[model samples]
Target: MNSFPVTKFYDSGKVHTTDTYYELLQLIDTKNIAFEVPKMGQKLPFDSVLGVQVLNVDSKASDNNDASIVLKAKYGKVSFLLTGDADVAIENTMLPKYDLKSTYLKAGHHGSNTSSSSNFINEVYPMGTVLSYGKDNSYGHPHKEVVSRLTTVKSKIYSTAVSGDVTVTTNGQAHSVSAKAWTPPTTTPTPPSAGTTGKLQVVKKDLSTEIVSIQNVGTTDVAMAGWKLVSVQGNQSFTFPTYTLKAGANVHVTSGPNAKSGGNYLKWTTANIWLNSGDPAKLYDSKGALIHEVK
Candidate 1:
């Protein structure tokens, strides 16, 4: 006896097979197998313990649209939407057809611009949005516009690129998100000294542009060569490039475009080096000694 893998298609008359399908057919002894065509508004008969619903499944839509499946799982009042690579078209079609509000949402198309429309996101109003994409992916998953839209909705966004293997636990009334792999940075911070360590203080921090200004408040000039500014959350560091800070002078370090080494500005070159919710900025000397830190 030979075993055959059974699959389902939307249209029974239009079923087609590929080369791999033909190879599998040859290995199976069964001459004919039936495929099930799920109805448009069909709901899976799962046990009452797990509340899962299939909201929409339109096979007449285009190839990408046809393959899309919008599913919502409910545990009492808490709900989750697990959308697989569904584009904006699929989302728009489902918006008015179903109740999309959920506690958690897996961002469509891995946060691609083709999906996660502002209208769709607003309709869902998820508390947390998770972008399931690889780190440094070639296609640049989680596009900035999508992220901005999610941010506008005040959604806590988590990306596999930054925090790996995120886990969410809920008891129907409340939910908490955590990543076991991510750990907060622990450092023995040094307090600001008046004149000994050059009195470096973080005068201002612009979270939007990741720009941090460190001022020398001491009476003597501070040799800034080999000094570093580090973010405690991400451990992102910016090293001074052979410059000297005179007394009462401030140097700006930006983590984005417009990097210049002139009168008072330096650039970190990397994007999003600082946490928006405020992280500790520690300044270290050339010998890896912590000189000053600002929270």
Candidate 2:
């Protein structure tokens, strides 16, 4: 665990917290994680807090979302501002209270117009802004006005609804984006060419063991590199490493706690994925064509 304190800056005064919050606090207590309450202008220890610095926390008390903890984090020269559902009222309260400029901004309240006010946008002038809202959500977040405001300032915008998730890698000063956009397969899986072994089968999938075994039933070798194994129910995928399956050979893709990687055993992850009730698995080739599926 990184030696950073998980700070809590808000608590209900007149409106008490829900039972869910009590349960969450209990879970945090069970984990032995250090939780703290912070004050303004207190910077966390630079060495142990994952290079993040604390700028300000709302000094006044509130019973609504405005009580959310707002923070700034930096790695080398790159900086980020994260506003947790804090609305425009909180933004205005913080404007003159702290140094709010940032390289990237996770727009408040999922880019709703209630937050990201023109005054605040003009103050930060972030290089890139992210709007995080579900696709076809009921509220229709990322309101057009907010997008227009960011555009007016020429800040590059990214949305999780458009791109499933956008990844950012920065060397402190410079940054790059890798979009994890999903697209459907255009054509069905086709048969292998003549004299080439094109057949494979998911012979077994055991939730108890968290392993999916695939056998090459064909007479030719099948390249497994770039292949993907997907959990249909969970909607999670794992890409295979560089390897090839010879004729009549089999490989086991394992997940969960007992997973181990080797020549014939490939570890997909260390977390439990297979459903206890029931789940299906799908195999896709490098060309995005379906190879096989098993329950």
Candidate 3:
């Protein structure tokens, strides 16, 4: 079995949105893969197998929307940065905060101009920059401006979108890197393309009022209408029952003495809202407005 230490840092002070990482760990728990957590920005034990940390600086508010952390590691004279999706502004703030004399950099934010600032590039002075992106991606990532900037700094560029997986091995001050492509199984199942359709429902409640939301989860658009409230948190759910709903719509109802103050709560709270009274409360949308509500 192989063991490694891993740590993650976030510039934005919020938990991540996905759990796919945890799922991967579960698969390797008893396999040939093992890991531990080492302190951030510090060296591993002399006999250690792996060390991980994040580069987050400044007295910025902690939010998930901020850029990703600036990761650094060293083994002898060779050091590496496994930058996730860090943008330019965050890079500008971070470069001055750390000793970033790295041999390699996992180029920030998929080679977007929003990162890879001139000042940040000079600070890193990376021997090479790695770009990980999907080929023919809809977003047209790895913008030309970013690539040209890296060239002006004379940084060698490698890419996953073109060359595939890049692996680096370091032994003290000496290091080497290699690349290989990852291919899916021949029998792999293909999922549906974009523009499919699914249904989703959201519900929010408080002592003063309750709110309900319905939405589309499918690839296709869904409309809002015909939703109702069937339950509540306060003691007056039964007496103040008059809910209205429409097909392909979301219905939100606020009941009880606290209903008046509910709108203010809606403006700032991260609470979920539902517009119906059912055990498996389902919501359907035939229009594309639900995404707007979410943002």
- The TM-score obtained by model 2 is 0.53
The number of residue pairs in model 3 that clash at the backbone is 46
Sort by lDDT, best first: what order?
A: 2, 1, 3
Residue by residue across 1-295, what tens digits does model 1's lDDT show? 1454453222212222234345544544253544444555566555665577776565554343335666788887889998876778778888888899998899887887878999999999988888888775434466777887888888888878788888888887887889533221245335223224567788887776677898989888887765778776544466676677889999998874444555788766644556566678888876678988888
Candidate 2 local lDDT, residue 253: 91
| Local distance difference test values of all predictions, in order | 0.70, 0.72, 0.49
| Each prediction's TM-score versus the true structure | 0.50, 0.53, 0.48
Question: How far does residue 35 in candidate 3 sit from its true spot (Å)?
Answer: 10
The lDDT, on a scale of 0 to 1, for candidate 3 is 0.49
Better of 1 and 2 by lDDT: 2
> Using TM-score as the measure, which candidate wins?
2
Off by over 4 Å in 1: 1-37, 180-295
Off by over 4 Å in 3: 1-13, 16-53, 57-67, 180-295
| Runs in model 2 lying further than 4 Å from the true structure | 1-16, 46-51, 180-295
Q: What is the lDDT of residue 155 in candidate 3?
A: 74
**For all candidates, what are the clash counts?**
0, 0, 46
lDDT of 2 by residue, 1-295 (tens): 2354554423322222334456656766776655665655556664653455544455354423555667788877788888867778878888998778888888988877778999999988898887888775423466677887888888888888888687779978788777642222346545323233268788999987899999999888987766778876544567776678888999999988789998899887776667656778998886667889887
Model 2 RMSD, rounded to 1 decimal: 14.0
Per-model RMSD to reference: 16.5, 14.0, 14.0
